[model samples]
Target: MYKISICVISFVFLFFLSVSLFTFSMNFLLNELTYFIEWEVVTLNSSSIVMTFLFDWISLMFMSFVLLISSLVIYYSKEYMAEDYNINRFIMLVLMFIMSMMLLIISPNLISILLGWDGLGLVSYCLVIYFQNVKSYNAGMLTALSNRIGDVALLLAIAWMLNYGGWNFIFYLELMKNDFDMMVIGALVMLAAMTKSAQIPFSSWLPAAMAAPTPVSALVHSSTLVTAGVYLLIRFNCLLENTWLGQFLLLFSGLTMFMAGLGANYEFDLKKIIALSTLSQLGLMMSILSMGFYKLAFFHLLTHALFKALLFMCAGAIIHNMKNSQDIRNMGNLVLQMPLTASCLNLANLALCGMPFLAGFYSKDLILEIVSLSYLNMFSFFLYFFSTGLTVCYSLRLVYYLMTGDFNSSSFMPLNDEGFVMLKGMMGLVIMAIIGGSILSWLIFPVPDMICLPSELKLLTLFVCLLGGISGYLISNVSLMFENKALNYYSMSNFIGTMWFLPIISTLGVINYPLKSGMMILKSFDQGWSEYFGGQMLYNSLKMNSSYNQLFQNNNLKIYLMSFIFWLIILTSLLII
Candidate 1:
């Protein structure tokens, strides 16, 4: 036992050290390689297949964001899983996950991208089921199965591109530059991305994934698995431009955002609420990306990683201290007990709610600005507005419920702060949530001529934040509306929280009609053939032999003779014919 414990500890330490080293190496290479390479392309086959390594603005920015978030999640997980008996297994899976994400981000070919993409899905299944409980096992199965469907779509898209466009394994530029059927490939890829990103119908798997531990949730939500779909869409942006598929994606993203935001507001479980919020935020990011604001989407992804990871880590701390109770109603006045955690939580909450000068303000405000300028129709505008309001409501509700409520006896415990390793991990994320925007704006985007915002829009956003915070607090503390509701009405909230199912039902309806008709036609043909040719039952009886059955039952010598004779007669008949 002692030896096993030592091995686990050493393995975990080495795993994290390796991730850090890889991150450092990537950063160094980014600097040195930029000086040597301007543009280079190498053809791999006669079919116009090629690979290009050009460090463009968009790719570099996304690559840096993914690497940074991945490293931080690793740091958080090291401490978050410190006490688990299977710490070594967890660390191994996390390292593998990071490797896959890194490969996907920097991959220059669709083949390499698919390799990393499928790798992420596989590792995520293992991580989700690390506990080996029945619930975790079921959740893992569901997530894996749903992701496989998406993978099939993506593979089909790739095959379509290679066959029709005569392009294979090349960079996205070459794929887009080809004069192929963009609409067909775009629709297929968009469908694949929607499922992977948990948009609308596919969003069910994300909340189910809350059966995993909080650290896993943070990694999946903020940095690794869920972002794969967004990456795919961004990579194929040119193909998607000026297509009906792009419009459908925009509409689907808007609906997902609205539903997920409402669900987040109604849920009381800390992790579930965060999971739903992650879905909503991902939807908002996708919506902006579809609008040609790729930079804005990338910025939101970065800020969200910082704040969402901080919030999840803090929630983990709270849950750990409370002996694993995840119910928000059971928690109150925790700020008095764990000041360090409360402070970090508050900072993250403020950032998520888009408080002025915070990281979320810069990213989310950019998205809103883009929406305003995009000339969307009324339906799109209404959906975006409602989702924004719900985002504010749920983010503030989490803040108030976790940090400041009436002191509940059930929520109190004789607990000390978590270790330095945990706090340090969370503090790094908190700092990013504070200053990430300024760094990205000044160094990355370098848009000094463009003003940050109009004074009117800035005031409106700030006012919305203040109003949401105040309203959420009042509803939680002063109002009797929720308390007085009947059991049936309370169940209605649960139904609303599961609204991701609506899209699933719609998708099923769309698929089932043709499927059912095809099955009926096949059945009719089978029946007609049976009536005309004595059916499968009669055919089976004609081939049956009493001797053969006896041989199977008793291993008798007579059976072998009969079998040989039957084969000889059949061979003779064939020769005569």
Candidate 2:
């Protein structure tokens, strides 16, 4: 009952606020209005310590989207975590997560953002480890440590910004383009965003963090934790635009997008596949921002959140019915058993693949067209297009497996779509997945993002999508019928399938040797020599001295007198002699 109350109260309040904010966002955009509310805490030595909040359509709409999704996810979690004893705790953590994201969204100061940023990292770690298992623990640690790297980068940026005698980066972003120290701050911010967004070299944590429950994945991966970096950079894009650091970001973001799409095709876990797609969309967002189109990046972020969350929820529903089996290979004929969930799953997958009229297409198609029009190198062009095809490929693969693939689970499996609680939660997003894009497109872009491209180039997006879909349908049939040849093409499969061994690299490669060295040092010094010579030596010396002192301390006067008499007799004998 408390769960229901918690969900209902929060859901109603947040959903209403989301609607109000969206209304306000439209008005703000039309009026070109922004409000800055600042409270001056103190002034010392020409530095002003202040708290600030910036309210514009961008921040407002983003906040609206976040709260909307968060409310639904909380409602969704009521049923998802019904059996767990610690569900109240889960609800609280998620609330904290949403608040942290709100803080991050509204803040323009580096000092202020850390409160939200660290809160996000801390709360996410709690969510990831909610199950309290070894796998969850490891994943939590990975998520925490990876985000900590970003935290450090942000701290460095703050330290560099100190030269300006203020912590608010909003005023300094443009100045960073000309000043070396300011540019250093920009570079640090870029690095921080990269780590936060789980770009290459920090990409493993996103997939690994699926150890968290599905609702957390739906929230954190879809819109909140993973999108924070892209949001930060979006606000700070003035510095990144036309800079060397931005160029570097572009390359890596492209690689991340490509890598995630390629990896998704090989992945089997339903949550992880969605997580990887989140990674791919993140890369797309980051890449577009690097090209100096922060608006598109932000637009995509909002739209992506809607469908991605839907995808995860549907996946959760499927996994819930499949007896918690996350392996896609174990799932088949799901469309018959769980029609509602399957339909939503395929819809979200289509949205992810940038199907026309879906939430994703409004942003994704525009982004690709923009990328095509930009004066990019051949390599960059290839990465953008190929990654798009891969997105369709993996998405189509999922659709086939869910819709038409043979029933691979046990014969006795009782899959059904009777979860009205879960379905009710998904209903809002299903509407959004279909109509959210058109609404957002109209609002975000008053006119339209008109692109003048050659016919061949114009048709390229559709062409690749079709080619990829055909290939994906064909590949799924061939691949599922045959045995997994992971062993035969060990090298290629291992490299591509394992996110290029990044999980091992991020978790093992980073810590393996240092942990081994720590163990060796622990054995040789602390356990061996230090134990023998330091603590043990002091212990033994103390024990022997304590024993000697015990003889007199035990009120042994007889022994003391006998010793004294013996000495006196010896002295007398010496004198007589």
Question: For this target, which candidate reaches the highest lDDT against the unseen true structure?
Answer: 2
- In order, candidate lDDTs are 0.73, 0.90
Of candidate 2, the 10-residue stretch with the lowest lDDT total is: 480-489
Model 1: clashing residue pairs? none
9-99 in candidate 1: lDDT tens per residue? 6445644564554454455544544311323344455534444343444455555565555555556666667678777677678778877
Q: What is the C-alpha RMSD of each candidate to the true structure, in Å?
A: 8.9, 4.5
Question: In candidate 2, how many Å is residue 566 off?
Answer: 25
lDDT of 2 by residue, 107-203 (tens): 9899889899999999999999988999999999999999999999999988888899888778776655688998898788888899989999999
In model 1, state the lDDT of residue 274.
Answer: 86
Model 1 scores a C-alpha lDDT of 0.73
Single out the weakest 10-residue window by summed lDDT for candidate 1: 33-42
Q: List candidate 2 segments past 4 Å from native.
A: 41-49, 481-486, 519-577
* Superposed Cα RMSD, model 2: 4.5
Clashes of each: 0, 0
